[model samples]
Target: MEYRKLTESEIVELQNQGCVASNWDSISVHRQFNTAYIRHVNFSGDIKLGIYEKEFTLPGGIKKHSGIKNVTLHNCEIGNNTFISDVNNYIANYKIGDNVFIHNLELMYVDHESSFGNGIEVTVLNETGGREVIIHDKLSASFAYIMSFYRHRPALIHKMQEIVKLYTQQNTSNIGTVGNNVKIINTGTIKNVRIRDYATIESTCHLENGTINSNEYDPVHIGYNVMAKDFIISSGSHVEDGTMLTRCFIGQACQLGHTYSASDSLFFSNCQGENGEACAIFAGPYTVTHHKSTLLISGMYSFMNAGSGSNQSNHMYKLGPIHQGVMERGGKTASDSYILWPAKIGAFSLVMGRHYRNSDTSKMPFSYLIEHDDETVLVPGVNLRSVGTIRDAQKFPKRDKRKDPHKMDQINFNLLSPYTVQKMFQGIEVLNELLSTCGEASVHYTYRGCRIKGSSLRSGLKYYDIAITKFLGNSIISRLSNCPCTSDEEIREYLKPDSSAGLDKWRDLAGLLAPSTEIDKLIEDIESGRLTCIEDINAVFEKLHKDYYSLEWTWAWDKIQEYFNLSPDTITAKDIITIVEKWKEAVVKLDWMIYEDARKEFSLPTHTSFGMDGNKKDQKIDFEQVRGIFEKNAFVEAVLEHIKVKSKLGEDTIERLSKCL
Candidate 1:
């Protein structure tokens, strides 16, 4: 884009069109600049103008030509075919890009040098400090997870924060950027912000010191009274409807609206917040709270949903809001439920009532923490056959709205990965230990500040065994896929792990599931300076996410041997056939359980709400009309189909294994 000094005739024409400049010599115009389009504009300091030969086709088929009208610009470079009009205050020290539209804005400027919200330390989990995540444009959920969760590694934290600092310095600039194809209309007070291509900021209020990392493919939308400071809004996100944010990082495809207020929080991919408040929280992928009275504070969460009036207390009075909690992935709180801080809930668990204890059930996945007569009762391994849990697992992958080709968060949507399955293994040990210590005849047992009924204990054992069999069977079948299982040597060769990467424990690093040993190796690299930069760390996380399945197979093989008590070196087709039988039985049984759970939704009690003006027959008809019959429900049908598929898969595998005879 070449610019030339304004000609004498063009200067006269601009002046005649009600334009004023501090100094005529400081303004430069494009070679084909037309003076007819510049109207009632005041230019100060320096200006580089572009030609206005394009017309924008707005909503309702209105055509408006691109040009400056009734605006003041200072030290700005205007781009080609852009439109600027009705700015209440001047836009200063900004580089406006091509095809951009700026209209009816109050103030858009850069007062001083700024980093555009990069390298801002967000205090997450423990608000008093300690667990601050250094936020930047490239920050990922797993990256933030390690930074906030691994506070014991001072060297690692320092190294990562230093890398962010360098990035912040590189982004520091006196001139703010409004990139190509942007639309800023009816906005107020945007200062020290760097906005990228295709971002639509309409009716937004008070955005300062932020970076809108928008792209053409998946543009960000900030609308209707959004006020944000010290933030980074990632691609394909929305901040609208009077939402207020401070010191936060909103990740890709997330939705925050309906007066939601968030401070010192980090929300990763596909998370949502509406009509609620979040403070000092780490909301990983699919964490959602849509109710008005809900509050998520000082916690680490992923794949969890907060019901209406759900609240967590971080202030223990003595600690001064320092205590934090963990609700591991796939957990949910019933409406009006509460929990005290410093508590740890297990994966796929449901919190159904208020609890005052600092209960820790981290090892018990797929459990129910319900308030039975004001006592915290743990019904373990119940959610394994829950209709809602399976439906949630199925919905997560389908609900992912991220359209960006380069997704910042490496999310794993698998419901039964080694991360949760390993917890099941430990949970089995925990339940058995509790039953043994309390004596099975005692009727009720206590463990980790929660009560377990005798019947629930036995049922938990059954559920965990079924889930384990299903998992182990799936792994062995997948390993033996396409193999000719005719000999012991061939079967053992097929069952052997391709690598030893996943032999040990597994971790859910926010959303990415990988082996503990591998995560430890990466941490060692970071602490020892082998992974010196954020990009290097991110590259490792990305690689771990991509290699998850192969690594998972390695972990599953070891668990199979240990759980089923089989030596891998001498494992034969007969041993595998035995595992398959257990797996087939487990699969059929669990599916039947889930099917029964689904049936409960359409039971007699549920019909009460359906037929308000009719009798039982009308209730049945109305219920079927509104919610469909249970047999034809999409989820029920899917479950039925799934049972058929898995049953066939199991039978096929058994027949193939019998060939060894």
Candidate 2:
């Protein structure tokens, strides 16, 4: 982009075209710059202009050539064919790229050296100083997790901070950039923000000190009345509808709209937040909150849906707003549900009512925490039979909205992964301990500050056993799917663990579900400084996510040996058939339970409010018309289909194993 001095006649032509300049000698233009259609523009300091040879199509059918009108520039460089018009304040210290459009903006300027929101400390989770994560352009949820939660490892934190600081230093500049083909129209007070290629910013209120990591393939959108500061929004994200954010790192394809407000929060890929407020929360992939009264504050969550009026109290009277809670992946809250902080809810569980007892249900995945008589009642492992849980697991992979090739978050959507299975195993132990300590005939047992009734305890044990059998059977079938059982030796070989990494324990680090040993290896790498780069850490998470099934089989095999008291080397066809039979029973029974649960939705009590203005026969007709017959419902049909499919799968596998006899 070479520039030469403007000719005297060209300057006089620009003056005749109503282009005023404080110093004509300070202005320069490209070789083919023409003064056609340039009007009422004030140029100050050093300025460079490129040729405006292209025409732009307006919102309607009209086309107009690219030209500047009613604008002021200070030390700016305008690119070729760009349209700058009606800038009320000025465009200063900026480099506008080719084909960029800036129209009806109040002010767009770069005052001093800025990293554009990189290296801004976001105090996440614990709203205190110790857990601050310095957000950078490439900061992923996993990296922020380590920086915020693993603060005990000072050296690792220091190294990560140093890397971010280095990246920020490399990105620091005084000249703001508006990349090619960007549209910044009806914007107000855009200061020190770097607009990437093909970004569409329309009717934005304010954007300051941020990086819009947009590109041509997946352009970012900042629509009407959005206000942000000290943020780094990734590619393919849409922040609009009066959303306000500060010190936030918005991940790819996430949506924040409808007057949503967030501060000191990190929302990862595919998260949708509307009409709610988030503060100091680590919102991982698929964390959605759509209610106006929902306030997600001082918590860690992923794959979660906060129901309407869902709230959590982070501070007791004594803790100084320091307490935080965790609702592991796939957890959901019923409407108006609340939980006091310093509590842990299990994965895929449902929280129905307000609970202030600080219950910890981590070891009891897929359960329900209900409030009864001012006490929290735990119904453990019952959600394994829930149709909603199965639907959520099935839909997450299909609902992934991330279009960027380089995905920052590694999401694992497995419903029966080792992360939940291990919790089931431990839940069995805890339930048994409760039953043993308090007589099995006792009406209720208390554990973890939550009450469990005797009937619920018994049913919970049954449900957990069924789930364990199902998971083990699923793993065994998958393992032997390719390996033909020509002989007993091949069966023995197939039964052995693929890797030692999954034998002991497993964890869900937000959404990355893997064996604890793999997580340990990552932590050890960080401790040894071998995995210093954030990209390297993210690569480890991706690898673990990729090898999930293999590692899961390793964990399941060991658990099978422990649960069934059988050596894999000596197991006969009869034993395998017995396991398959158990799997069939478990699968059908759970599906039937879900079917019955679905039936409850269409019961007489449920239909009472539905047929409000009808007689008895008309009520029945109206209910059938509006809600449809229970048997013909979509979810009920799906449940019936699931039962048939799973039962057939079990029987087919058993028939395959019966040949080994």
Candidate 3:
């Protein structure tokens, strides 16, 4: 976009059209610029203007000519075919991109050298600022997870912080940018903000020191009284409806609206917050809170759903608001639930009622923490067979709205992964120990500040066994799905792991599930100064995500060796057949349990409140109208189909192995 000095005749014409410039010599215009399109505009400092050659077709098929009108600009470059109209307070020190439309804006400017919200320390997880993650455009939840939680590794933290500082220095500039094809209308007081391509800012109240990382494929939208400061909003996200954010990083495809307020929080991909409040929290992928009364404070959560009035206390009487909590992936809170800080809830667990006890259930996944008579009663391994649990797992992948090819958060939606399965294994051992020490007839046993009833303990063991069997079976079946070998040597060779990276403990890094060894290797690289760029760290996480399945096979094979007591060197076809039989039983049994649980929704007890002032027949009809019959439900039918498929799979495998016998 080359510019030439304004002609003497054009300057006279601009003056006749009520346009004035502080210094005529400092003004430059595009070669094809016409004086007819510049009207009643005041320019100060150095100004470069482009030709207004096109018209913008706005909503409702209204076409508006592209030109500068009734605007005051300072040290600005207006790109080709862009329109700036009715800027009340002036736009200063900005590069306006091509095809942009800015109308009726109160002010948009960069007052000083600014990084546009990069390298801003968001004090998340703890309000008193012990765990502060520097927010940046390239920051992933997994990356932030390490920075905020892995503080024990000072070298790694220092290296990461240095990298972010470098990024900030590289991006620091005196001029902000409004990218191509963007629309900013009826906005108020935008300062030191970098708006990216195709972003839509409509009726926004205020935006200060932020970076909107928008793109053509996944454009961000800020609408209706949004007040954001010190933020980085990623692609495909929408912040609207009187939402207020300070020191926050809104990740890709997230939605924050309906007067939601968040301070010092980090929201990862696919998170949604409506009519709620968040303070100093780490909201990982799929963390949702829709109700107005719910408040998430000083906690770390992922794949979580907070019901209405769900709240947590971050401060005890003796200290400041410094306490924090961790709710592992797939955790949920029932309506009006409350949890005290410094508590750790397990994965796939549900919390109900008010509980002040600082309970820890990190090793017990798929459980329920219920407040009963001022005591926290933990029912472990119950969510494994829950209909809602399976539904949520199925919906997350389907509901992912991120259209960007480069997704920052590497999310794993698996309900039964090595991370959770390992916990289940530990949960079974803990339950067994409880039974041994307290005696089977004791009826109620205590663990981790919660009471576990006798029936729940036995059920927990059964549930863990079923899930473990199902996971191991899935791995073996996938390995042998296309196996052409029939001999024992070929079978052992087929069973051998392709990679040994996942043989030990696994971790759920916010939402990404991978082996701890892989994560440690990444941290080691960072500590050793091998990975200095944030992109390099993200690339490592992506590589680990891509190689998840092959790595999972290594861990599964190790578990197989431990459980079956057969090494890969001596494993036989008969042993595999036995394992398949047990897998068949496990799969069918769990599916049956889930199916029965789904049936409970249609039971008479569940319909007690339905069909008011009507008979039993009306109650049945009313329940069926809203909840539908259990047999015809989509999830129930899928479960039934899964049972059939697994039964046939087991039969086929057993038949194939019988030929070796």
Per model, state how many residue pairs clash. Answer: 0, 0, 0
lDDT of 3 by residue, 181-277 (tens): 9999999999999999999999999999999999999999999999999999999999999999999999999999999999999999999999999
Q: Model 1 off-target regions past 4 Å?
A: none
Q: In candidate 2, what are the lDDT values of residues 536-601, reduced to their tens digit?
A: 788888898889888888888888788888897797667777888988898888889888878888
Give the poorly placed runs of model 3, Cα more than 4 Å off: 608-615
- Ordered by lDDT, highest first, the candidates read 3, 1, 2
In candidate 1, clashing pairs total 0
Q: For this target, which candidate reaches the highest lDDT against the unseen true structure?
A: 3
Q: Between the candidate structures 1 and 2, which one is better when assessed by TM-score?
A: 1
**What pairs collide in candidate 3?**
none
Which of the two, 1 or 3, has more lDDT? 3
- Model 1, 211-259: lDDT tens digits are 9999998999999999999999999999999999999999999999999
Model 2 has an lDDT value of 0.89
**Which 10 residues in a row give candidate 3 its minimum summed lDDT?**
481-490
Q: Assess candidate 2 and give its TM-score to the true structure.
A: 0.95
